[model samples]
Every structure is written in structure tokens, then in C-alpha cells.
Target: MSYELQALIGPAELVAVAAAEVPAARPRLLAQGLALIPATPEFLAAFRVGDEATAAPAAAVSPSGTAASAGFDWFPGGLERRLAAWSKAGPIACVEADYFGGTGTQRAAVWADGRLDLGPITSAELEPFPPEGSPISRALRRLGARVTEGDDAVRDEFDAVGLGAHRATVSWVSAG
Candidate 1:
């Protein structure tokens, strides 16, 4: 199987703010009480502020106000400034992962309290995992996703948060 995702994870209120900026944001609830808004093609088209595909995706707001927006391009200009503004209310994590044919790459960055907190971390195939773990894992931790410690069957932050339920970003749109 192969998996690829690009997303922003953060407080539900903040994520909702991000979503509202877009024209047709669809928010969905996932396991672990997290909310997700996949960056479907339609969503991306509606979200663009100008030419050059400046917008990323919509957002999902959890009951607890923890949310995520998937299928984003982090390198676009002004995204960081927007995320920083949203982080004033809470922390936000930008996460990306691509895995296929036994090789993969992951990247993540976090904004909190109006500034960049952790990463723009990147890890790729054949490289050792970072001491803190993969980029997504680290970003999830910053977003309050927890792991089961001292257990025979250990689950990392990503698994604990149930992000694996969808193998692809597009799957999230039709997911129940």
C-alpha cells in the first residue's frame, strides 16, 4: 500500500477559522475525536486566493476544537503568515508524508502562540528517524496527540490519533 498526505493540524477553532476563509470547506470527524477537512480538488479550487495556487485546503473542527486540514502545499507564499495568525489562538501543525514501494518521506512544522514552535523538520527514505521520531509524529505530539507508553503494544502519536484510517488524502472526503 501507499500513503501520501499534506495537512495542517491544530485547535478546532483555529482550524475552523482557516476553513471559513475557503469557499466550500467540508469538515469531517475522525477517530480519537479529531476532525479533518481533506483538501479535495474542489476544496482547493475554492480556496485559492489568487493565481499560483496560493491556498492549501479546508479544515475540520473537532468537538474539542482540535482539527486538521489535509492536502496542502506548504511552500506557497503567505501560508506561514496565515498559520501564524491562527496560532495565536492555539498551536497548529503542518504535516506531510509520502510512502510507496518501501520508501517514504515526511515533513512537519508547527506554529504556536503566534510564532513557529517546532520544525519544518524533514525525514526521507534511507535516513535514520529523528530522535523525537518522524516529522508527523513530532507534530502530532505538539498538537496534544499522545502515545501509549510502557505497554506491550505501543502506539505512536499518529496511530493513537487514528490518522491511518485513510491511506490517501482523497479517501478522507468519502470516509464515513
Candidate 2:
């Protein structure tokens, strides 16, 4: 199976703030009781109201009580400011992954306390299981995803969080 996703993951309350601001935002649930708000195409269009150059929509997830928001302009001035504002509550991660038949690229960045805490880290398509501290792994760790003992199949924070449950951002919307 292939996977394609772009999202912001952070605290549930902070994510709710993002959802409330968007027009027609829908919430879904992921494994481990995480909340997900898929940034449907409509919502992305609304989020880009003032900034036409925005690349994606905004989404968030939390650690204790996770939340996922799919599709955000991962790195744009306006969105960065907004993410900084949201980070006042806690860390927020912008993660993008696209794997065609289990081989593709992944990258992520994190904001916390109004600052860029982690990456802008990128992983090559050939390195599916990036070593510790890789972009997505670090970002997921920042968001509180953890590896359990003796789970050989679940290698990193990404697997720990069960993000592969959905194939795309639109799937999240349809599931909602």
C-alpha cells in the first residue's frame, strides 16, 4: 500500500483551536485515542484565504491526548507565525510523508514555545527506517509517540503512533 500525508500534530486543545478556526473542519479519531482533523481540500482553500502561496492546510495532534490535522503550508511565514502561536501551548509538528509501496520520502519540523525546536529534517526515499533522530521520528517523539518494548515490527515513533491507518489526507476527511 501507498501512503501520502501532510499534517500538524500536537496537543488536543491546541488542535481544537485550529479546527474551530477553520470552516467545516471535521474531526476523526486514530489509534491510541488520538484526535484527527483532516484538512479537507475545502478547508485548505479557506486556510489559504489571505496567503495564496500557502502550500497545505493546518492539522495537529497531541501526546497524552493526540490530535492530527492533515495538510498545512508546512513552511510559510504566516503559517509559521500561527504555529508559533499554537506552540505557546506546547510543541507542534509539521510532518509530510509519501511512500509508494513502502518506499518514499518523509520530512518534518517542530515548533515549541514560539520557536523552531526540532527539524526541517528530511529522509531519503531509500531510508525507510531512518535511524534515531531522523526527521519524522524526532517529530513523532516530540509529539509523544513512543516505542513499546519487544515490538519488533514497530520500529519508530511513526509506527508507534499508527499513522499508516489512513492512506491520504482525503481519506481522513471521508472517514470523518
Candidate 3:
């Protein structure tokens, strides 16, 4: 009944997250301003450009003209980033991820299908990135989600990385 967390390091095209370890610190990643999938290595690398994401929220890669033209909202309240990040590791979106019986814990494998089929990588070198922030909280606020209720904080921590805390109360399935 233990769940480990991990973060995929790659781009939307293809992603390979870091090794799954006993998650230590969970930092919320914001990608609204950036408009890129937070799951990709490129995006994570972009975030690596600086460690500010550790101190605050981090913006995801900005959606290109194509993704925008495709009617994709750059900031699906951070849903895109969350989806990409979770999918890379092969799990269901926590938001979409279900909690059974409304109590206890559940063990299962889940896979996520990120929304919006964005587009090819652009050479438009993302703007000079900035300090990071809590993308999860921001997205939650944007979506007007009641994250404060129940195990929302645990889910938020898990979304920041790839696994929820040990005390997340709610049940979560593994995306094996």
C-alpha cells in the first residue's frame, strides 16, 4: 500500500521521466504563461534553465501558433501540463483519476491521454524563462476547483511531481 512518485523528463513528442523514487519534495509547476506540456523533457529542461521552479511555480512551454490555432487553450488551467506529465509516467490525470469508495486506498495501474494534440516543436526558442511558481495551485484556482477539500493537497503535491504523499488519504492507482 505504498506509492512512489516520479517525473518524466522529455518533450510532448516523447518523454522519459526520472527514476521513480520515494518522493521527497513536491513542487507545484505552473505552465499557463509558458503554454507547453510540463511533462516533456524539453519543458523540464527549460524549467532546469533555473531552479526557481523549486522556490516557486514554473511556467510550461508556451504553445506554438499551431497549438493556439488548433483552438487549444495554452492554459487549460494547467491541465495540459498535468496531463502530459502524468501521461509520460503512464497514469490517469489526478483530476480525471478516480478515487473509489470515497475512502481507504486503491491500487491499480492507470494511463493518461493528454488533451490537445499541440504540434511540431518550434524553433522559437521559448522566451527567457522566469522564476517558477505553484502551477498546480494556479491551475486549481483558474479551474475554480475546490482543492482545499479532502485530499486535494495530496493530489496537488502528486501533480507537482508524479506521486502523491504517503498521507494523501485518498486512494490512487499505479499506471503500470
Candidate 4:
């Protein structure tokens, strides 16, 4: 399985967190404001963000969207990177996406204040965004901000934008 992730990070610290935590991978530039990071299955299995274990399941956004029933661990190295990079940015919003098991996709939107909305956009509603970008990239770009993917060496590239960092939070959901 392969998981592709796209995040709209708000607050500079959140971008730092994502940069630090997001597994090393090459991302594609979807537009001026969006980037897509693809991850290996092993990394996906170890992904976890703040308060995720205690987070409640979010409602399904589409027929295929479902709440996650179990907890998963974030890789130690990734988690440490996030903590180490915490800093200040203006308020920022993020959309974290994951795709696995063929057509299945899952998504969550994290707010700087620690609220998270989890689910996937309806496939029909996501037609304009190509596979190269994923639905989240399109949604983030629509906000009229600029986003880009960083290479392995510059994962914290988003932090340079001065957007405030969020108090990381995640709500897990599944979609097919």
C-alpha cells in the first residue's frame, strides 16, 4: 500500500511539525499553493499525531468514509522531529491525506487550535484534481495560498513562510 499525504499547515510550528514528522518522500507540485507527498506503507502504519489516541471518530463525509477503530503509533524519529521543530507561525490550516488499498483514501483537516475533521472528499467531487495532486491539494490551493513540497533535505521548508504553527491534532477516518 502507498499513502500520499497533503497538508495545509497553519501557524509556523505546525508546518515544522509536519515537516519533521512527514516521512521522507518526494512530493509533486500541484499548483502555486499545493504539494503532494507520497509515503511507503511502513510509514503509514506508524503515523500518529497529537491526541489521536483520544480523539473521537469523525462522521463519514462520503459513503466510503469510515472512522478508524484502533490506534496506530507515529514513528519515534518522526515524532521527535515534529517536537523539535515546534515554533510560531500565524494561524494555519492543514489537510492530511492518505491513500492505500488501491482506490481507498482517507483524510483529515487539522486546525491550529487542535480541532480535526476527518473524512475524504467524494470521488465525483474530486474529479478536477488529478491523481498527481490528490483532492486535498486542490482544496488547499483553492484557499488562494501558495504551498509546495520540500525535498528530503528541506522538509521544514513550509516553516519559512511564517504561518503560525498549530497545536497538532488528528481525527482518523477511512474511505474507499
Higher-scoring candidate on TM-score, 2 or 4: 2
Cα lDDT tens digits, model 2, 37-93, are 664566545545676544433333211211223222343334565777878887877
Root-mean-square deviation of candidate 2: 6.8
Better-scoring candidate (lDDT), 1 or 3: 1
Which candidate achieves the best lDDT against the true structure?
1
What CA RMSD would you report for each candidate? 7.3, 6.8, 16.0, 12.1
TM-score for candidate 3, please give it. 0.20
Candidate 1 displacement at residue 73 in angstroms: 5.2
**Whole-model lDDT values for every prediction:** 0.67, 0.66, 0.29, 0.33
lDDT rank, highest first? 1, 2, 4, 3
Model 3 lDDT per residue over 1-176, tens place: 43322222222222223222112212232222111122322333433334443223222343343232222222222333444555553333222111333322211112245443322112112322123213233322332223334755444432443334322312121221
lDDT of 1 by residue, 1-176 (tens): 79987666775666777778765656656444455566566665543457443443323221121222322343443455567787888888877788997688887878898877887677868787857788888988888877877854546777877778788877776674
What tens-digit string does per-residue lDDT give for candidate 4 at 1-176? 54444344333334444545555423333323433332334334344335453222322111122212111122222322232233222223334434445554434332222222332333332344455344343334333344445544322223323211221121111210
Where model 1 places Cα greater than 4 Å from the true spot, the runs are 31-33, 45-47, 51-74, 150-154
lDDT of 1 at 10: 70
Poorest lDDT segment (10 consecutive residues) of candidate 1:
60-69
What TM-score, computed on C-alpha atoms, does each candidate reach? 0.76, 0.76, 0.20, 0.32
